[model samples]
Target chain A: MNDVIICRCEGVRLSEIEQAIREGASAVPGVKKRTRAGMGPCQGRVCQRVVLQLLQQPPSEAGESPDALQRSRSPVRPTLLGDL
Target chain B: MNDACDVAVVGAGPAGLVAAIEAARAGLSVTVVDEFPWPGGRLLGQLYTDPRSHGRWDGRKISRQLAQEAGELGVRILGGATVWAVGRDLSLELSGVPVGTLRPQALLLATGAAERALPVPGWTKPGVVCVGAAQTFTNVHHVAIGRRVLVAGIDPLALSVAMEMHHAGVDVAGVVLPPVSTTSGALASPERAVARLADVADLAPNGLLRAAARLAAGKLSPLAVSALRFDLVRVGGVSIGFRTALVAVEGDGRVESATLRSVAPDGTLVGPERRIEVDAVCISAGLYPLTDLAEIAGCPMVEVEELGGLVPLHGPGLETPLERLFVAGNLTGIEGAKVAIAQGRQAGCSIARSLGRATLVSPEDAARAVSDARTSSPFRFQPRIAAGRAAMAELWQQAIARGDQSA
Candidate 1:
């Protein structure tokens, strides 16, 4: 049970993510939507890097090479829905 | 057929930026669209250029760096494109031009916020300005409104504007706050540490005297000052003053002035009516949730009296009542940039995991993100926002009725 709640706005706990993963969640996005981990006020600006690091880590290793993780996308910020 | 991405993140602000970057990192094809010619949305336009003088954050540099990073990630970035409407088909009309429809498996709406206006006498005067507009002018355009300016409202942004004005060598008359204390009455506890960090005393006197002295010192370039008596009124920690200028604030297709009797601390107007004169009136009145797109798309929205108005109701994963659609950023509630970004990342990760493309983050990581997001936001629920909303609605109704009578 990690004390660090990554997405404060939504009150998401990291342990919840681990639990969801243990329960069969596969990807970061899936885990996030289900857990409401990063859907808070800040919108993932601060948590993205942490999530990325987690995704890049090998499931078995402490600090595995980046090859195991998926590639991240761009625009790393919120845009207006009307402007999309 | 239109160009497609695995995710289409709109509004390039904190939320959109994180969403695009995370989705792309996860090997999802992503396209981030923005109405502005550049990224960073409001930050690019205001915070970056005129960053807080005392803060370590360099808004402009950060935005530029973020833009570069997004480019490096191979995310297609479109700027100077206005997204007018989102259709049921999940297609968007960019500007007036019709672009091909995209069926992104996931969509993130991070469209930030819009400034709320208060109706008052002479508000339409040329000197009156939206605190944000003044910020954009100073930060983005490198322009100043006047040698001396009066900034109203108690929002942090208003204080930031006053700071920017000081930096730009403009005099800040003072910040005006309504008599009501916190936006949320006692019931609402501070949601974030930042919300608890405000020192009202520090912001008040300094903001007032600094602006007044600057004006008295004639630090600004020569501008016309008509025969108007400047009255500086200090309320609580807030200070307000009037300047003599028949100027009107008109641009971007809206008139920005009105006449109303002054109001008391109890929200009652004082006197029959007294015209307050000001060269430039800046309203830091606050913000309203922009839920038009979400509403049109049939996302369930709840009017959280504490959270402003019309916030979409979503459980974990940014999921609303509508399946397969996710919302991130201020659309949920108006917190700040940092929170919006964290939410975007979580949304991206959640969507990716749901799609079976990436592994879910550990509970540790998720917890850290949540805590950090909470700490970064400073806004609390305020009843004044609701009151302001009601007052504005009444004003609008009265205006419409008057218009009808005239017709």
Candidate 2:
């Protein structure tokens, strides 16, 4: 099967996310760091929940734990560099 | 716009507008901020008939009424304004139309919900979109998504949006089930999807369609599944492809055609895949609470499957762990718009009480209104909402006991 795009903003593929999960990415932030799924302009608004569901898949040696959201920082909305 | 107000309601949807109205009525200066160009949030796209009242309930009209009421009560609604950053001290840094920071005494986050994504092979294509997004374009913006559309996934939202599109003179090619996957759950199976569809069968546009839906939902459900496996059923002139799953979409830059395959009663792919030419494909994966703002504000979030997803811990009065931060509407959980309005009223009253002010409606009364609205809600998005609410209350109690304090 073709690798479906998971992160629309960054064009992260599902295979990449699966590889990240195989490489001990148990949570959204971990996946974001490894695959940049939630590191796009929308900042995970579109792909965060999808990544969370993907992380909840079983048989993970990373051990089960509650999911955590990425810490939201300043300029939550897209702002121009001059605006800052 | 004023730099600050007594209360800042972020959304301007049914919940935020009602909350602002109640708070302003209590003599608290209220300001509302919304990212949308208009004040009405998701309500702008809603147009349905009340199964009880048998009258059309246009969401855009209701939104205008609420927005007007809030304005009469002296609420400042900053449409097209985005709260880019929220501070622990109830300070909101906004952009767009009103480009400045405003510090309010209390903050109410009614950020609402977003559609869940059901990604297929060609979902990223230009003509592919969510059912709600299509609804917004067709009903709100008066823009047609496509000349002919194939809607995948059989849910209340999908069915309703299909009907709305049909009424708007769009050729709704068919409604099919999504590909069988872990995330698809009940919708993956034909039998389960039929049962779930039967729950909201009354919402069908015409009586004949409603009768068919009820029959399919009732003792005839098994027979309906068999029929679906064999052939398609036309409901209200729109083809209902039962036992059929959309496996993949094939297109060049835009949606061109979708691959449909027959599924067994157990939701396993059975027959050969067939391609149907379609300009648009609307995936209805369902909805989840938009908790980005709550997460940003550092509110404690708990996962409640029945509520659709992770929601902030809030009391019956919609008060969060943060002293003056409250959440209402879909942000708390996925419920109908009426329940959101009731919750808004309750949150407004709670905010008034927390601020030690007198209000027209007591918090208890507002709470009762919420219960009333919940019971009377035509569409119960989640069947186990009561259970979700109970679990949330327990979580709130546990969080309090553990002293999980937040800023």
Candidate 3:
């Protein structure tokens, strides 16, 4: 409970996200690029929502809402080879 | 069986099966598309004796019955159809290499509910899964989820799955409620917690009732006392760690153990933290109706926490704001299988009434079908569910009315 691990797949902590935001990560993609929070096996299925909640605060609230930011990505599911 | 169908039903769960049956019986050409390789949805995996009657409910039988009825009525069932997207134009984007299109006169979304992710620390591990996933592995695939399991919750899903796992000879370490101190501590609310615990007794009340009858001058029945224990409830016959909240899951490569810390009702840590070594963890909060297809179809949605989350606003007959696009079952709200079946019948009749040129299923007949199917089960949670639905509908109406005024 003390040390909360948000991104379980990659073992990324909330502190890491906060640090990424402090390090000039503006939006979800920026935080993702810096922290690798949503680039795990589940493909952000679990952490995307958590990342959205984390990005709702100050400094990261510059551009579009977190809802719109999360929705901007395509291929929502793990696309199979046949789907291509 | 063609690309053009009178009615297209998505997700061949109980609701979709019922909807397809009703529509096809009413002489509408029906097409049921499901992502599963087979029908039955979650019902296939829920193999347990009904707590009320102590009679084993073969969910497969009824599912097969509905599937048979749909087939008999000439309903084309595409078991492995993965609908990538659904459009307001009543056309569907198929899965895998751009398959053919489906343009039905009407669409029924029986997409049902997804197991709500209980995002705790270490949940993204390999062996940590939801109860529904555990049940599917055991019941559908006949594969054991794990040799030893830790279930994190005490609701109907947790209790039932624990019992099922125990029956399958999988060692159920315990069923524990999430710590009240946690952020997702809705169980700390007296009303919600009481309702949840009362539901435990309501599940297997016969043992409680018989024990009560044997009580000496209204004394606490020891038999009832032990039977109502978290460990003893629902023939689970496993350990139950009360006041325990899963804080983290620890494992080397796969899931190895879960950390359970006890907390008081006021969100205060009360006791020592205990670590239960286990291979699998079945974490469950509740089920939320999947509304992606409904949203893709541009149906107006409102967040209803009672139904597990955001749900499409619809009329009594399951017709969404976007007409010709109906939703049934848990896709509307997370009630239960019986309610879903009734709503599916209602949707089928409604779709037939609106879309069919010469129909056999009338509105009155549909209404009767829904009513008849709704009250047969002595389900105790229906009252709370009804209240939740009423509140949700009220909120939806208020939102709509405000939009009218502003417009």
Model 1, position B84: C-alpha lDDT score:
54
On residues B279-375, what C-alpha lDDT tens digit does candidate 3 reach at each position? 9988876666776677777776665555555677776667776769888988877766777787888898888878745456666776666555544
Which is superior by DockQ, 1 or 2? 2
TM-score of 3: 0.80
lDDT score at residue B167, model 3, on the 0-100 scale: 76
Per-residue lDDT value at B305 in model 1: 41
Task: Estimate the overall C-alpha local distance difference test score of candidate 3.
Answer: 0.67
Q: Which stretches of candidate 1 lie over 4 Å from their true place?
A: A1-84, B45-55, B96-98, B178-277, B378-407
Model 3 bad stretches (over 4 Å): A1-12, A16-76, A80-84, B51-55, B96-99, B179-183, B188-194, B203-236, B357-383, B395-407
Candidate 1 residue lDDT tens string, B13-131:
87788777777777888788877777887666444221223454555666787778778888877787655556655555555224545567777777776655442323444666777
List, in the given order, the native-contact fraction of each candidate.
0.01, 0.36, 0.08
lDDT of candidate 1 at residue B345, scale 0 to 100 = 79
Per lDDT, the best of the predicted structures is 2
lDDT of 2 by residue, B8-81 (tens): 99999999999999999889999999999888888898887777778887899999999999999889888888
What DockQ does each prediction reach against the true complex? 0.02, 0.41, 0.17
Docking class of 3: incorrect
Give per-residue lDDT, candidate 3, residue B337. 74
Measured with C-alpha atoms, the lDDT of residue B392 in candidate 2 is: 85
